[model samples]
Target: MKKFNSTIYMSGKYLFVGMLLLALLGSCGNNADKTNDTGKQKREQLPAQAGKEKAKTIVFFGNSLTAGYGVDPSEAFPALVQEKIDSLHLPYKVVNAGLSGETTAGGKSRIDWILRQPVDIFVLELGGNDGLRGIPIAETSRNLQAIISRVREKNPQVKIVLAGMQVPPNMGRTYASAFRVVFQQLAANNQIDLIPFLLENVGGISHLNQADGIHPNPQGHKIVAENVWRVIQGLL
Candidate 1:
């Protein structure tokens, strides 16, 4: 009887120890699972955090000049501007929204589509086509104003830069003067920044222009980029 009792007591002791060991192992497994879950959550959040730090966008909306007509797209002034920004390590991404022959009226029609994406700085380079086409000064002004209004409506914080242009003397001095005045008036009235002349040094120079004498060549684009940088650097 004594031996049997001792055997029974030993069996009970072993069973309790086994159960304690199992409980300890289960607790360790739960702690490890909790740590792994936390690590997984942090990994998932990393991309979202990085996305928040992505570069801001600058939209250069214009016509053939901005499109780099008769030249490689990389040789365009907007691309040159991008190169300058990159060289300075600026936190901006330049979007060249330059359609080859877009006028102010056309730009007005499509401004909403362009605004579908976020635009931090908006460089308006229309009106040159309007001048070339001999569009009415009032009509051009109204279209440009409407585009500006729409941009402001979409994003009140957007910084606007209007590029001033002058029609050829052949377009008539009065008409040419009025065309040039439109940009100044709009810039003052809207309280926006202005690029006094987008093609300042490159406009009438035969060597600086392409064979067409209207669009800038690669060398001219470098000067245009400098012109743009002077105006936009302060804003940046």
Candidate 2:
């Protein structure tokens, strides 16, 4: 397990370096075919705590996968997680902050706004786009580290879950291997929870994915929810 021994902060120098190193695609545009849900999936609002009573909150932050791009919002894993939370009577609220084409840079820019209120758990699910585009691994790592730092800085007690992702091996064994290592290194360096493979048992499985072969379908999301639930149960 990683050790959390230091208070985190975003170093301006590092952010400036990361910014200079990027020529990545636009953030608000559509996802690539692998990650896109064909732009046909209808978006839905997540479960809300109607009573207005105060409860700890968990936020799912990422791109298409987190957005449930090709599936109903209710079928998203985060929503599934909310279902579990409610059924178990856990004292927590769920917020899904996913966007179809969001990258780590986009996420870093918007994290503070998302942290407007206290959050008990923050699940960081980004970097897939970075790997897909073959952006500098160093830049991807820095952006994620900044995100994790900002989250901790905002809520010192918040538990962070870093979701690991993989690009096709066609990206080259060296690149693919390095990309996978990025998440593991971050998890260890930050001492946060890690989901080794976000698409475990689902990736490369035709039946579990939409036509895109990138984003998971509703059924695939059920397994994704299980992947996350196992790690977060103790924290909750």
- Clash count per candidate: 0, 0
lDDT string, candidate 2, 6-27, tens digits: 2222465566667765524433
Q: Write the per-residue lDDT of candidate 1 for residues 1-236, one digit (tens) a residue.
A: 99999999999999999999999999999999999999999999998897666799999999989988988999998999899888987889999999988999899999999999999999999999889889999999999999999999999999999999988988999999999999999999999999999999999999999888899999999899999999999988
TM-score of 2: 0.77
On lDDT, the leading prediction is 1
- In model 1, pairs of residues that clash are none
Off by over 4 Å in 1: 1-52
Question: Which residue window of length 10 is worst by lDDT in model 1?
Answer: 47-56
TM-score of each: 0.78, 0.77
Q: State how far residue 71 of model 2 sits from its true place (Å).
A: 0.7
- In candidate 1, clashing pairs total 0
